[model samples]
Target chain A: MLVGYLGPLGTYSHAAALQQYPEEELKPYGTLEAVVEGVKNSEVELAVLPVENSTNGEVRAALDALIAEIGECPEIKAVGEVRVRIAHQLFSRSSNVSQVERIYSHPQVWGQASHWLSSTLPGAKCIDCDSTSQAIERAWEDKNGAAIAGSAAGSVYGIKPLIANVSDRDENTTRFLVLAKQPAPENKQHTMVTFCAAQQDLCKTLEALVSSGVQVTFLTSRPLGTHWTYRYIVEFAGALASEQVREALAKLNQVTPVTVIGAY
Target chain B: MLVGYLGPLGTYSHAAALQQYPEEELKPYGTLEAVVEGVKNSEVELAVLPVENSTNGEVRAALDALIAEIGECPEIKAVGEVRVRIAHQLFSRSSNVSQVERIYSHPQVWGQASHWLSSTLPGAKCIDCDSTSQAIERAWEDKNGAAIAGSAAGSVYGIKPLIANVSDRDENTTRFLVLAKQPAPENKQHTMVTFCAAQQDLCKTLEALVSSGVQVTFLTSRPLGTHWTYRYIVEFAGALASEQVREALAKLNQVTPVTVIGAY
Candidate 1:
């Protein structure tokens, strides 16, 4: 299947998409809109986007696109939840880290790396870019400049890493979601549901679910940007075969339009 | 009151803080944690953080810290709200935009500028950094580099703007939350709430709130990184002062610990 994602290459979305599908089958798009359109037009079989990061928050374009899709949009079926292992390295084309006068990477990295960078390279500054590879691309032109990105980015932009995994925590990972016209089969172990809540009551929601017997596997919530509205992604187990699951869903339909994002 | 925020200067947060406080009373913290700690230690009378962006997503660190503080610590209190006008600019030491070989900015700026950057500076490499001021600081050390950041960041980092308002959209603005140890005098206009729900059945929880007459103002849900589950920030109208609101919250609290983050 053809997989579409946002890239100039070397973005985590590209890495996660490749991890889920055949690398050779990867098709990169410049925008989240284009990626979604690819699936809608059948230009590609599936699209992958960063749904949320452990530290970053929700990718609004992805969420906005979700609402924009509405009914005629693809049935966002199976979610290939890929947890990207982030290792933001200080990269360059030259010899040592001491020679670096400037570093570059995504702003999220810069925000996360502030304490270490301000201490480690007191004089050197960090530049922000769209992707880690872009940092490498920028560094290729300057001898004193370095880039903070992943090791995978090194190959794409023809550079070497000055240091590896400069992030604060080693357990840094961003979870990605796969959007397609078709979701996976109901026999899948993991299922994802996205819905908007009128209130921020997690307890009552859980009560209703547990009262019906749906074992939650994982869950994440993000804002809908309209003051105090939210959308949630919940991963639950016990297959769609369980009568309790069906009955619980019927009960939920009474509350809101709970879209089955995926079952994997 | 002296307010602190992440800056070399001229980040949206800086502007947002100024909009809220005015009178140029911001302390300009280098890191978000520094800002949080500043508020905690009373280094600044108050601090501001960009909670959500219209086109972008949560300024992750701020959200993480806020949730962690409200849910885990409860030492800090949400006090005020401000709207920041985000004006993306292409900045450089050189006055000519055509001579610019590279561009820099925070990843959020680059994400918002992808289309414009791709079309405007196709050959120029875009890199991400900690903030707009940081990007301007990096570009100042290089002659060929241009940075995309805020107009105010220019004066703060000693750089100049080549073009103003380079974001993909013009209506972009980020809403920041002002935090303090003391709560603001009670206002019924803005109310913030934090709640945790069952990993499954968020719909049911939300239904209880809506059915109870809580008109949501803003909502985004994402993982809190505690127990691998999720928590949400919901903005609603009217304070818990109203009997109906208190009753809804009381009933909602039966299912979850629905705490009032703040109402201003």
Candidate 2:
């Protein structure tokens, strides 16, 4: 098996890809676009992308990238879901934590580890790098610099951990979705759908799903960006291929706009 | 009146604060926590914080900050809402766009303007600064650097716009919420509620709101971080103080965990 993920290496996505397809060839794509492109172009069998974080909510770029491909490109469907526990390790060239004069990481990682950073390296200047791997690379090159990233990234970059499990929340985790050219085999537990509906029609649409007895697992609304109108992505406890779920979606489509994205 | 916002000066929050209270004294708080803290401590009469962006969706930090204060601290309510059009300006020490060897901006701004940058300044190295204002400050100090920020921020930092309206989307806008120690006078047009509910009970909850004939304006769910459960923030076209809305909420409370964050 071949898998693609966002990385230089040692990112949460990297861990997720490995967790899903261990012993398979894993390719690291520098950007989200590249990872999706890898799947679209058949450069890889499937791509794993971070969808949301427990603490931060949605990963905007990843969702935006997937949504952008909805109408114009090869239909990449989410086939599998994986959740990875996020444990940030502060890595530096020197093992001594006191020698760290600067800290570097992706801005979001900085937020996750802010409490530890404030208490441990109060005076260290924080620098924003493009990715956690890039931060590790910078910390490896600069003796006075440290980075917060996956512990796996530290070993990959040949840096040692200055501190372990530095994120404020021990239960911090990220949800990743596996994207491929096809949807996953019909899943009865959940079906992900995306739709755009007028403000007045929203309740009616939700009523349809509820009336049909399908349980909603996740619900999120994003602005379509031009008008005040919004786009909603929903995951409900049902299968797209099932009769009750299909009938519910059919009724929703009659009253409002809706698209069944995936079932997993 | 003194108002607090996230800023060096010239961030969307700064623009929002000025838009809401043109004649008031705007105090630039460097962090979201500080802006909320300013309101909690009565250091500023109120604060403006960016809650969501049209292009990218919710600003997780601001939402999390507000949610964190739900039970642990003094109640801070959203008193007002402001939507500002995002028109990023490329500013530099020199007026010549071709002379720009490096580009500086916040990561989100960079993502918004990536299409323009790749075509216009193909060779320029991109640097991520703490804020758009900080980006402008860096550009002002470096002759060969350019920053992407609000035009007002560029002018505030004494840097001239090399180009205007560089964001890829012309309709890009951000929605900001005004925070104060007290809630706004009850808004009949809409009420905002934040609550946690079970996945199975979600359908019953939506059915309750819709059955009461209250329109749901916005709906979003965030993972509670520890368990597989989720927390939801909802805005509906009815007042919390109204009879219909109260009846609907009371019915929901009977089945699931729910909280009324604000009436406006």
Candidate 3:
């Protein structure tokens, strides 16, 4: 099977794809939308896209792609999920961290390692790159520059880790969703649902789900392309194949338009 | 009165501050945290901070600052809000848009104007700067570069707008909150609350709010600096002075530990 991921090629997404499908053929796409499109166009059997990070909250681009695809293309669905531990390392050609004048990284990396960077490199100027790999490349070319990326990416670029695990929080993990043309087999452990409803109706819908004894694990609301209107993406601890989940979803459908993204 | 905002003089936050308090003396801070700190430290009578953008959803850094301040400092509160219409213009020192080989912007602007950039300047490389004003300065220095910023920013830098209103959505407006040491007058129209609760209790709390006929306007969940646990930030359309809102909040307090961020 061919799996697509956002990469070039040392992103946490690349790490996730490798962790989820060690033996499978993996292809790197330039953008999250492209990775999702690969699965939608059937160019790849599966695609790994990061949905949320423990430190950074939701991965907006990835979540937006998932919401757009699942909402517009009925066949495209999230089939599974993989959680990857993210350990960002400072890579530089120079041996001394004190000599680094500037650091390059993806914007997300800057947010996660902000505290560490502020304390350690108070004078270093931070620059944003399109990807961590691109940052590493920039760092390699600049004598006084460093980049934040995974250890895997540093090895790929022949750069040494000046500092390891620079994230503000120790347990920084990212959750990536596997997307496919069809939903996963019904034997999975969790079900993810997306729905749109008015504010009052949304409250009632949650009440109905809770009353039915559904354990909702994660929930987030995104604007539904208009001011003040929102659509919610929810993940719960039960498979769609289970009767309790089905009944809960049925109740939710009655109150609001609900889309079961997948069970996994 | 004095106001603080995130700026190097010409950011959307500056526009928001001007829109909200044209008569006040406005001071610019380097980051969102600094703007919030100005209010907490009584350095500024009020601080205008962007909370959410219609096109880009919530401003994460601003939201994070609000969450941290309101959670830690009881005196810090969001007192009022101002909505500013955002119109992103491609400003360049050169007269021709096609000659622009690179585009500079804050990371959020890239997300907001992505579609316009990809279609209009397909060949241009995007470079992220700390702020839109910084992007404008970079564009002024780079012979073949353009920056996405408000037309006001363009005027300040003496750069002309090569193309105007590049945001993906036509109704691109950002909601800015006025943060102060004390809550707004209770006669205002809305109340905002933040609370951390277990997943099940969260649903119950929402149900409780709904039962009292409170209208929820905005709701978002952020990770509580941990793996799976989350804290919810909610805005409702009733002032704390109103009987219905007070009753609803009383019930909410019974269910979870609720912090009334403020009323406005």
Candidate 2's DockQ is 0.63
lDDT of 2 by residue, A138-242 (tens): 887899998889977876777667688898889888889888887555754678888887677788788887777777877888777655567888887777777
lDDT of 3 at A91: 90
Compute the lDDT of residue A235 as modeled in candidate 2.
84
Q: Which candidate has the top score in DockQ?
A: 2
Error of 3 at B153 (Å): 2.3
Compared with the true structure, all predictions reach lDDT values of 0.71, 0.80, 0.84
Q: How many backbone clashes does candidate 2 have?
A: 0
Q: TM-score of candidate 2's chain B against its reference?
A: 0.90
B230-251: candidate 3 lDDT, tens digit per residue: 8888888887899888888888
Q: Which ten residues in a row are the worst by lDDT in model 1 chain B? A: B220-229
Model 1: residues with Cα > 4 Å off, grouped in runs: A1-264, B70-75, B155-160, B201-204, B226-228
Write candidate 3's Cα lDDT for A153-224 as tens digits. 876677678887788888988888889999555778899888886665666676667667777788888876
lDDT of 2 at B115: 86
Model 3 chain A scores worst on lDDT over the 10 consecutive residues at A198-207
- How does candidate 2 score on lDDT? 0.80
Best by lDDT, which number?
3
